[model samples]
Target chain A: MSNKSLIVTLLATTLLSGPAFAEDVTLTIESWRNDDLTLWQDKIIPAFEASHPGIKVKFTPSAPAEYNAVLNSKLDAGSAGDLITCRPFDASLALYDAGHLADVSGLENMSNFSDVAKSAWQTDDGSATFCVPMASVIHGFIYNKEAFEEVGVEVPQTETEFFAALDKFKEDGSYIPLAMGTNDQWEAATMGYNNIGPNYWKGEEGRLALIKGEQKLTDDQWVAPYRTLAKWSDYLGDGYEAQTYPDSQNLFTLGRAAIYPAGSWEITGFNAQADFEMGAFKPPVQNEGDTCYISDHTDIAIGLNAKSENADAAKTFLNWVGSEEFATIYANALPGFFSLSSFDVAMEDPLAQEFVSWRGECESTIRSTYQILSRGTPNLENETWGASVAAIKGTKSAEDLGKELQDGLASWYEPQQ
Target chain B: MKSPRIKSHVIVFLAPAVLVYTAIMIFPLFNTLRLALYTEADQVRMFVGLENFRTLFGDPRWSESFWNALANNFWFFVIHMLVQNPIGIALAAILSHPRLRFAAFYRSAIFVPTILSFVIVGFAWKLILSPIWGIAPDLLSAVGLKSLFAPWLGKEEYALTTLALISVWQFVGIPMMLIYAALLSIPEEVLEAGEVDGITGMAAFWKIKLPLILPSIGIISILTFVGNFNAFDLIYTAQGALAGPDFSTDILGTFMYRTFFGFQLQLGDPHMGSAIATAMFGIILVGVCIYLFGIQTRLKRYQF
Candidate 1:
């Protein structure tokens, strides 16, 4: 055929297929993950388009820190993406209350999600489901098996042994005992300090005390953890404060630090490195009396925009994300500990298996620091904690630090209480 | 007395821009301020008058945060004023020098960071400063100053100041270009006359060039004031919403975000957020006013 005739024929075919061929509607999925995950979107969306025959998915990524800022800005400006990853906190609740997120209860496959995940997505006002759960990222301390082995230390299971192992590692001078980079303030809690703090200082009883307001943040018990953190700080290489979040992780990966107190989401990135024998442990407890706690941070849990024009498409997407096929897809692409109750998909990473085991064995739940510290305390309390960490380390009395926290909490809790 | 056709044309010409500005900027800004006066209860909003503002400034929990961020925000602005604008002026003066080579390349290189998305700048800097991953230590080691490399972004004492300097580094090009353009616009004869009268080099810059660019400098200062107060993305991206190493880098923007969006446990209060926004707006307005009434009028425009 002549070039003109062939071009005309192709145009006619495209016209005949119309929106139905390309998945007529283009929907944007907003997430805070790195743009490197565009591969997932580019591949998955095409498959969905081909199978469903009418939906083109566009991925709109935001910086993880600025995710909320961007989401708020977009929602405020009334130009938010159709689908967005939502968190289980007041921030998400606020967005829901603002009438920015659409009610997604009527999605056909809502029943596939676990009860906890479902409740997490529900608005605080007992309103309709406004979001869908994606990957359930849980946080804990992960260590390099090779580094631990090289240093002749076994992964400490109990809290007492955890510190002992670190001490041993320190004595041997083979590895930096703990690979924690506290430069990122949130890691002090999320990956290490906060997750392990409640387990060690408060335990389940302490956690209960905190919830009931029987204990302020500066209780005498908090001293132990603060001291422990200070001890850990000594093992950190000189000029550790210069490290960023990714830097700290890289240290662990590069075997500069023996252990990284971080979340399970990091396993994929860590495992990708060659010759790393990595195992994750819930922040170790000092005694069996204490709870072996692992803080949960479900990564990229998705929800519908309350004002989404493509509510039906969003519903379909949410249900698909919760489906077994979706589970398999996620497992194949980005394998980690997800919060799906469906027994269909298996975990790929061994660290995830360890996380799953600890999660399964958990007897009680203490809300993570991100939840408590964020929810109970007003903003910038963490900032105060960062300064206070140094203060306490600098021969400042634990009592004084505790009192400061007590005073601080009193200021925050008094008004809200 | 205006003709109907002229009036219609004027309205038509301005309608789109005005509508968009109001809808996107002015209306939301006012709405945010209004939201500050209301509190959320069981997902429903309650009108609380000045309660939110009161909580923000008076309640210990809110007040501590507000004051810290406020103080930090002021410091952030002061740094920009002291470092960014002056440096920009200096660079602009140098770059605008007669027969300077590679001026375009230097200008472009300096402005590159400003055009980059906040994520790139935040992470890139974070990487550069990372003792574990960054080459800063390696580069420093080459110069025998590796001991100087510390995670500036992670330390409570250094985080804010470090980030401020980073911001100044990225944004200096803006004021530089602005002052440069303004400097170029000054009449050459005036400069020549100044030269003839014995004012030259540093004297010419300080006595002659500096006075002429006062209005532009004033504009840059106010812009800095407003921008610094409203700043979020850089700190948020580099520091996270928690603004940690224990919130050392917490500024008004991050504080406002945590309050408005509820990070973990604390419920987000829109009223409080709105109150914060209103406070920011008030602060910015006061700053602009001070510049307009107190400073700008005294800084003679030097039309010549």
Candidate 2:
């Protein structure tokens, strides 16, 4: 046989063998959704894998409390999964800044996200998108509808009315006016200060001004919110300091408290455990007729590891996550969290619906304390939270709390300058 | 050495353990110290000699939390020393008595909590002390001391002390067991000699037994010092990363963790975290040194 003819025969043989040689790519997705493992195992993964042939997704779950640290170690070791779930702001930004996150900006479904959601996963310069926005959580007071009706109190729209409602509950003396669990210091900041502080700060502009050093936390506007928080502390009832996050949730669910301020994440737990009818309301504004602000923050977003060997497969999965199809699946599976995508899903839960209704109705949605304080500033939340605890305990005045916040902010802001 | 050289098998047998120890313990220890000298800014890590340490000590924001945690840690140690050691010593004394009944059962029961996970112990105590649950309150009320139940774990003034006590309750068995073993090794002849010399019971223990067990007690004290200073899991499990009720229960371990990992709103600064860790290492080193030189040297171990 001629050499050319022999070579042609070998080439033809290799080409024919290619179909059998193709390997299924396995993409590992790391997440802190241990509680919702069933959702991923039963629904999300199967749906993704079904559509994308020759690709298998391996879900790696860790406890939420240890997820970031675990992810950090993995990333440092250059052994992180192909896909990673990151907390929005500092957590995602840190990875993005370190060039550990793959810039999936060219993903076709990026346009499906709103500007707010898009900005969350993007760099400060808006030059790179590190992750696909999955869900944004709403923070508000989860109240007992039965207790409100029994006391003939309308859902408060204003701070004055809110205080009056608390008085009504206090007068009834059968239930706690507000369930506050400051024992876990973050809870006070999360449920109390952050939920209420934004109403006084106006919105994103006010928060940005503070972040940019254009406004001091000790300013009258900022101080007013803390004062309001201090006043609200009065309605927490005796032994409120001793109350834990779970205890507060238990109190609200058991009809011991009229109102429980928390994030929408607790909806599923509340619904399953609560014996009485539960309703949610946006925290009241300073004035009777003023527009109230809702505390909205990104819950979880999917980021691709830049160092992943299966980058193409990871991007494919992330692009799918940004699609309307994935949004539907996500929304159906975790109905409590509001999807950040333009894709609309009907929320059947009344409490969740109430929060969704506030998306357009409320004056504005602002970042939660965790997001605001976590950016570039170290221990600001703890310091501010400590001050808030002191204010609630009547050990420190609201003015002192404001000053302390100002001092803490200056410590962070001055060093940067 | 010239007469007989070490065998190849000795080196072969020793290499695995030495390699394992160096990889797990010594390498990481030195690496953590090395990380302390570098600071990351805008995702770029730069070598900044002593800058992180200076910031930790001089910066009000870092220093304040550092000092508060340090102070609280000291108090935590003091509580264990004052309440835990004494109680453990007394329990060991009682249990080690020749005439004691159900000694085995009591020893096992007392040591049970020590074997349990810190997470379980912390959460268990948290629930037991919860005011809303009425477990602690009802118990207090039963004794007509309900007013005295002031939510000790929730109060800034009391949170650290309450947690310290809880830690003590869980770990008292450790010192008890160690001291008990030491007491059991007391030869009986020496104790009999004490009895004959008019040193009976309390006199025998205080004059004869305790002095002989001083070396063991010293070792236990140093162990307690190290354990208490390095405590994190209990506080983190119970009060959370914030170590809250306004960080009153914040200890060095929790502080280092929060600084290292960055909790809530704070970005994790590895350099700063490492500096804090290095500081902790120094503190531990100093403590170990003091025990070895200042305390351990004076504690004469008997030949018994």
Candidate 3:
């Protein structure tokens, strides 16, 4: 008799809650940018909600390094959020091919992004666009202004000058010359190799050529960067082999390190932690007259979950994500992340301004291994990470590392073969 | 009719436990083993039948990483066997002394790390050992031994060993406690007998206490083997998924995790992951079986 009453009570409660829940559509976003949680909740989501009263949005994020694993598991279990944050290149491309992410070509203001901006999320044949281009991070060095004065060095423009300044810092005895570590291996590659690489590769020309199999990694353009990276360890203070990403950041921000090999993404973070004034400089050119090329890598984008129940509301949210207003908000909220859109944003932060200003001064290219080249076994990105660390540590010669990368690529990547 | 009546009670009582076990343990174990035998081919899940194992063992890329992980895993285990166990046994011996004062304080202090989360232990040690801002350099410098310090966690040469020691520091308490309890449970009359025979202190421990606690020590050894093989969190927290300083610390668990779950830009292949898991299972099974069928039978278990 009590069982029947319990069943009736459950039915009644379900009926009551169902209608109330339906009154407002809540869309959850999966992202790896945990640092931007408060910014999203306070500004981005509230702004979106204010425009669309019936739709509510929640921004959920996991650790940056664990994001790929977390998102894949969640998607496999059918518990993914309505909106999915997208990594650049083959990683997100896999999700799109798997039908986990929906096409967003029909999204409002989709045309606002350039061909280059949408290049990361588009199908190989350039038929379908799956994610809205959000932001790109430029690679450079973030230096302490005070440290520069103490070391008696001006901002370096040439590779020779860069090394000279590093030598000066070393002689000064108070500061670490270059602040970067191989502990978290990606920082060693992302901030070290990829940052300085384009200066040798000639940016998009070499990257595109490498993709087409016209330029091998063994070529002078590619191997030259590794040769340069081998010298980086000497300036990286003693015991840098064990120093982590956070340690490097702390070293620079605490005014103990003169220059930090950086992605523009570090601006917001460095700004928060640092007390001393900071400045930004692009990767120093090998020659005085050489055209500088920056790694203006498209970092993150957002796409719709194909299996979302609130597809319409999610589409509405995605359309907003493509807009200039969203671009401005996101780019400014995270100063280091410049908008991928053609919309020229006036960044309030000076360090960010310095990074973005390079777009006009230099040719820009994404990381060489990020695109289709990394699709196979012995992933090129992973290979580059180890290779970079080895280069810095001088455990492997540049020639050997180049051959290893090529060999690994040839083992799987057909174009390289 | 009476037999049927008796069987019904057994079936009813056994049903819940049997069902739960099958769902959680038995099913997953079989499924993982089954998955090791299959793989995705042309977007279709098909029976590859030893293909994954062939690739794992024969292919240079797969085999190199596999062998490396296996070797590192052995080293990780050897460190525990050589260092952690001996330290634990020594601590247990010292603490078991009847004349020892503040034994409770020492026991609690030593055992505290064992109860702490792997994440806390990993990060805490990482911080303590950090060269940039860590206290380790400061502490060493204070003693004029600053030159003796190197970035232990960052160097490829020392990363695995340093991590092993940190792990030993965290988990030494487990074996210590087990051996302590085993030592305490030995009848006081036995010690009294040893006292009358000139077997006191070290001699008494070697002759009386050590032999009786051999079973417990055996159990602790097996437990350490299993725990070390299964370790992922501490390494993941301290080093990261790639187990860096150039994958120097990659063990079976991390390798399996990286293969199965993927990390960074590398895509996960569950079939390959399952194959690695199966390999790990085989290794562990061999260890456990040796302990159970060979070692355990030789060790004498005593009763009061």
Candidate 4:
């Protein structure tokens, strides 16, 4: 080959490689629901790329349960993504404490959100901020409105009426009163134990007592929820343990279950069904004196991994999530209750608007239970609460369950110092 | 003396496999074992001797779960022993039938599930058995056994069994193929000779074929035992580490995972997790030793 031809080819190759140097940043953002939220990646991310010009955002998703596992492994290896999604509660406090999370303390638009949301988003007792709440979710019983109407039951306002309505549905043979999936243990704990039990336990006080080790999980006060759950189990379809979240959801949507106790995250999935017009309501207390409690967790949040190679780009992305542009897209496409401070996205879905209005009353009395119960309580669910489910099923007695939970949690709570 | 070239030749021939094995297997194995002898406080690891083991076996919090999972793991192993190997053996024997049509198709069809990722299988099974969907009920009703249709996966009484059956369904083909290879290795002259001696059909299978294939069956059983004891993928994919419906399906592998990586309530403790891993390794080692020395020794093979 001639030297001139070779020099020309090399020059062309170097010019092509120059753009690669300019577009040097690849920010990996990992979440559990990239497939579920395909719109965000296809539309919103491209919009960001068009505006930003030189940065590329690679969306990495892991399987639901394995997401956290993979994330933790990455963190341990010091190779975590630039942006990560986490549900910020008591469980996530350890990640914050370990210095694995970047503090997005002074990010713009932090002042606009509610104090409760900001507090919820913070990791180090509100001093350090780790994540920005991408979406807020509320947990309540989502009833099939048509199913309830067929059974001549109104939304139960009190605990007595709730149980009566459930019984009435059971008597009519129209549908199972409550369709619960236990394939995920946390489902039971979320709907059965954390939601209703806390209401019966006198709300936040009861949770605090458990957290402080002042109240034993075996105490007689705890028996009511177990008995209530045992009764609730009678209405669950046979082979319910094998049933997963989506399966149980199909029960409610298909008109097999009158009441499906789940979170508002299920609303979109429910709305897609042709068989039912879904409605959301809080579970009624067994007694009039009992305050209604709603169980909840942040559906998703954006946090910067402390080990990110590109912290500036990660910060910019997080800032956009909290910005009005991102929130508008999220609210319009996703239809979740956006927790941001200043967004003029009109309340589009009538059903979702009703939930938003009701959420005001719900959050007023809303208290966190699982956080206190879960924090520092090792094997408490598996050995105690899980055994309780089996015990209530007549595999073991209630007394045996009480003893098992009491003994298991004693070591967990006993002074380690 | 042997030539100096002989020593160099041996090293050259064996070097690649030995180096690869040492890097991948021996190093990680020892590292995991070494990690078991440490404790973590505020993210810093400290040497803790056997305290982690003591905590695993002695502390009420860890001991009960550890023991329960160990028991469940044994039951899981038992199910494989009772179901997988026998079905595999039967299918292998039948497929080894030279008269059978489309043997390759049957073999391939049955073996398809073994290639599926446990995540896919777990979700697929979860959807198929969901009572709300009514597919399971429809199938059962068609079989004239609709009354037997119940939520099998959700009930604590039946969760483990259902999961075991699902696992066995997926894995039976492995043993089937292994034993099929072994059965084909047996010469046609022995079977023809058996037929000539008036030992034919079921009798020939029982008297002559079964004895020769005993070693293959033994190997399959040992493999099943080891696989079942180490089983985690399906349960983890389906139920998470907590193995819910109140931990009814908690097995040793899941328990080990929960210990290693903290879930909603528990903090991750690598020391305890490593100890559990060590315990699992020991159990598997003991089982392998027993199979090697005991079952393998008793199963005599006469070359045909």
TM-score of each: 0.78, 0.93, 0.95, 0.87
**What tens digits encode model 3's per-residue C-alpha lDDT throughout A100-129?**
999889876898999999999999998899
Q: How accurate is candidate 2 locally (lDDT)?
A: 0.84
Best by TM-score, which number?
3
What digit string (tens of lDDT, one per residue) describes model 4 on residues A137-180? 66668788888888899888787788888888889987988888
The CAPRI-style docking tier of model 3 reads medium
- Alpha-carbon interface RMSD of model 2? 2.0
Per-residue lDDT of A1-417 in model 2, one digit per residue for the tens? 699999999999899878755667899988988878888889999999899988899888998878888888999999899999978776788888788898888999998987778777787778888899999888888899999999899998887788899999999999999898678766767677777877888877677777666777778877776677777677885677888878888888888899988888888889889999988888888776677677787778999999999888888899999988888888767767888998787767787888878888775555634444545555566677777677677788888888877776665565323
Better of 2 and 4 by DockQ: 2
lDDT of 1 by residue, A92-193 (tens): 766776777777777777777765566566765456777766666666778878877787887777766887888887898868777665565556545545
Interface RMSD of 1: 3.8
Query: Which residue runs of candidate 1 sit more than 4 Å off their true CA positions?
Result: A1-86, A89-140, A158-160, A171-174, A201-205, A213-223, A287-335, A338-348, A359-417, B1-17, B95-117, B181-207, B261-267, B301-303
Comparing 2 and 3 on DockQ, the stronger one: 3
How many Å off is the CA of A148 in candidate 2? 1.7
Per-residue lDDT of candidate 3, residues B1-304 (tens digit):
4554466888999999999999999999999999999998556789989999999999999999999999999999999999999999999999999899999999999999999999999999999998877899999999999999999998888999999999999999999999999989999998998898888978988999999999998999999999988888889999989998888999999999999988788988999999999999999999999999999998877778
Which candidate order results from sorting by TM-score in descending order? Answer: 3, 2, 4, 1
- The worst-scoring run of ten residues by lDDT in candidate 1 chain A lies at A363-372
Give one digit per residue, the lDDT tens place, for model 4 in B140-199: 999999899877776767888889999999999999999999989988899899899999
Which is the winner by lDDT between candidate 3 and candidate 4? 3
Candidate 2's TM-score: 0.93
Which of the predicted structures, 2 or 3, would earn the higher TM-score when compared with the native?
Answer: 3
Clashing pairs in 2: A374-B265
